[model samples]
Target chain A: MDDPRPTSGPVPPRRPSGRLEESKGPLVEPSAGASASGPHEQPGLGHLLANCEGQELQPGLHAALEVCRPNTADLDDPALAEVQAALAADAGLRRRLASLQQFDQALVAALRDVRAPAGLEDRLLKAVSALAHSEGVEPLVEVEAALLAPSSDAASASCVPPASAEADHAACRDEAGYTSVRSGCLAPDTVLPSKRRAMRLSSRPMVLAASLVLVVGAGLVIWQYRRPASLPTPQQLANEATGQFQQDLSEGDGMPASKKWPAQVPASFPQLRLPQGTKWRTCRLVNVSAVMFDVTQAGVKGALYVVRAREVARGAQVPNTPSRVVFTQGVSRTMWRQGDYLCVLIVEGDEQALRRLLRPVPPVT
Target chain B: MVQDKPQDGIAELVARYHRELFAYAYRLTGRAADAEDLTQQTFLAACAAYHSLRDARCARGWLYAILRSQYLKQFSRARRLVINEDPTELEQIPEELPYEPDFDQELLQQALDRLPAEFKVVVLMFYFEGCSYKEIAEQLKLPPGTVMSRLARAKQRLRDALLHTGQPAFNGSMEAGVPQVVREGTPHVGG
Candidate 1:
């Protein structure tokens, strides 16, 4: 069967590739060479031969030869179909068309790859430097230098931000050009997005939900994991924190303690103004640290009392009867005398050393 | 603005992706200025909330994650883009680069600069990095189909613009630039 009527949709009379692309993928206009493809090329040679066979062009061949260029309009007519078919039949024509298409694709790719000009690069660099300098140039200096190098503005601009003066601040980072590093160290926030503007579905809501879920789920999670409550309220924790601080301040420096109180605050301590032969529950002497005391002398319990480095700073001392037990010892420590501030610490053990540990109960006034 | 001392892995991630991240930024906002600012802020934000990062190697995704959040924040502060119609495929891409002038690459760049925001980004990632559609989809959080159509529309638009006009002051191309892509009706094959 005859090759089923030129299936390739109206072979479209021979025209420039540029125009062909324009009407299809691109808008390639006719090249300056367009006018040169005048009429003679069309009616194609076949039509001319037919006309000659019909006895009309023997006279005109010379005229046609005399006329140099082909009429582009004639080449664009439907009558050129017969000639086109004839050309298609020729292997040479087929190869030529393929070669032309390849050439066209090469041209497009070349154009695509073209680099930005040096002037543009220079301007971009200068602008980048200026912007970077404005932001205090320590970090962007390298990028500024890269801008000054000989890259074409096309590549730079195609890749870089616009050259408008307003964009100077925005262009500082781009000035140095971009470098790829391992994920997770550099700030992606710093890179200018080329498109889509990084749209997000939700903002505070996600965070709110996450944190809320974290808190609510935490109870369930903790129930599942049975983790300890690692934290407590300020006041309840204050005493504990105070104890740690005292240890850090005093014993941390390797100085010995004045007197020793059992690790757990003592079960009892002698009270002030007790009857002649009466023994009393010793009050717990929890060290509040740093010129503060937690001596529970019967009536007193828990943490409260101020001690000081300087005698005068110690303020007034409470008076008790004749054989009072006062815990005091001046040791070689850099703490207390560091501009008149005192620190305290609680240590373990008792008596035999008590006397050496205790200072004279203020010489009964 | 990146968190050099990030609060968590995600924050570190923002800093890690800082430089390479701008290409995406520029692609998103269609303005280099906006992209840079957006990037810096994203890093800063990442650092501020380091606890949010779950994966370290997914840093690129993580940073991009922050950029998305930050961009939204910026949107409320100032009006950057106001897309009405579900922006045509062309609208999604950057314009096609045109012929170089005297071998100057800027002309082609100028053409690219004119493409729509989304389209331009897709093209950059595809041409410059040759990222797979899946990767693009993941980064942008767009459906893979959307990425494909966007890319197709972007390419066709670029081809159209390069062939038509390659000037800074020129206005509109029909189905050429990102804004006015001509519907080839059928997908473009070899052409």
Candidate 2:
């Protein structure tokens, strides 16, 4: 059978072998009297050919000799004349050359005779496509477009979010080296027939409804997983009081020397008062009116916020005693309902310090 | 205007050259399964390095180079090929054949599989890929004389095996390297 590929297809240019260049040098003939073979002396053709009888020539000399043979011999080689003369002079050498030539021809024929398996191309394509996908390399644009084509029922396609898909498509199209076979937007016809068939047969409203239900179920599961938590009522009151205290320190007016509550202080908290020498300021926090007092006790700075008992949070038992304490953000807070008002003291020191400040409240005179 | 990417033609490239590449791979590794794997790897690798291929006309050579590189990377470490120290004395051919012999593909492949890796590669590039001695030298980064010497040694070894003039055509004595196929009388090829 004729070989499927007769010529070397699209072969790169062959670089000329160094053997040809080496063979271009003048052939030096041995003198008739030169009979002794030495490492320094160049052997005659007869001696060189005979040397192959039981041993191999050195690689360099071997290449030079082989290049004088018919298959690979450079016709322009100066040594070709001497090698041919020597071959003509020896029948044994001529026979060996003939055998070598036949053997080379036979090897070439055998090697080229074998054919690739019939399914190799298909397998290769599929393997390469799968490899590209696994490695995150995009397939040819047409195959990518086919895989991402939206179904005819826009509602069914909503799960894929066509706006994002279109944006990606536009970005891919604008990429410098990305190639597209078609000029404009992807046409529905470019989708595979099998895919188109599946779409046509399975685009029922019931399937779309089931898909939507699955999506909603997934959303519910995620929502249940991430629900926000509510803090305990007592802790909530402590957080709000401490927040107002930190805010007053950073943004509220400087404390006035009046240790006594201002007249504007809600009458609901008339019972609330601090140490006599402490300075005071009045501020409203949310729906609750409160007075912020800057108190120094035992040389330690602290803040006290007083709000009405009802302002603490509905149903939260008014912390009437000094036992309720909350620690947050490096400040310790103690809250207790003083008569009709809630008094919260925030200090960077221990809870004992807070107890000391409020223990001898020094009745408001 | 958007130009078609060269990568888009990879599928077409497979169709055009797969057979030839597979044949070359089969010559190097004497089994259909291994040849398929090597050829597949070549195309897969080509997809990644496709940009380095500046000329479409030389795609055949480029693909062949990738296949050779992949083969060496895979087998070079796993198998240690034993190159006979003496190249000229590697094989002795009979002065003449009893009759003109018919060459069998299997026999030739078995003979090829027996050659050292370096020689086998040179032979394949020279005869199978139609690369010149200098081309093989450049690809393998060896001297041109070394390429010719290895080619000659490989051809002689193949000649003796095919002629069956030497002691039992391939004794399957594969030093440390793996045999390309299950030889006759052996249950399986060994590593």
Q: Which candidate number has the best DockQ?
A: 2
DockQ of each: 0.05, 0.14
Best of the candidates, TM-score: 2
Worst 10 residues of 1 chain A by lDDT: A62-71
Error of 1 at A258 (Å): 76
What residue runs in model 2 are displaced by over 4 Å at the alpha carbon? Answer: A1-59, A63-98, A121-354, A357-365, B1-16, B44-57, B75-78, B90-99, B114-118, B145-149, B156-191
Q: Label model 2 with its docking quality class.
A: incorrect
Q: TM-score, B chain, candidate 1?
A: 0.53
- Give the per-residue lDDT of model 2 (tens digit) for A1-365: 11232222221111111111011112322223222432134222223223336543333444434433234434244534555555556544543444344344434544565444545566666655554454333333223222221222112111121123422232122222111111111111111222232232234344556889999999988765443222234456567767766665567555556766566444433333355666677665554567777865666657777766654454566666666666677677877676766777787667766666655545568
lDDT of 2 by residue, B26-136 (tens): 777766556666677667666655554554555665666667666655544444667665746412444333112334445566677777666777778666665555555
lDDT by residue (B1-191, candidate 1, tens digit) is: 33333333333343344445554554445344565556654554443344334334334444454554444434423433322323333122222222111111222344555665555555554543334444455555566656656655555455445444543222222222234333232222111
Interface root mean square deviation per prediction: 20.0, 19.3
Second chain TM-score, each model: 0.53, 0.77
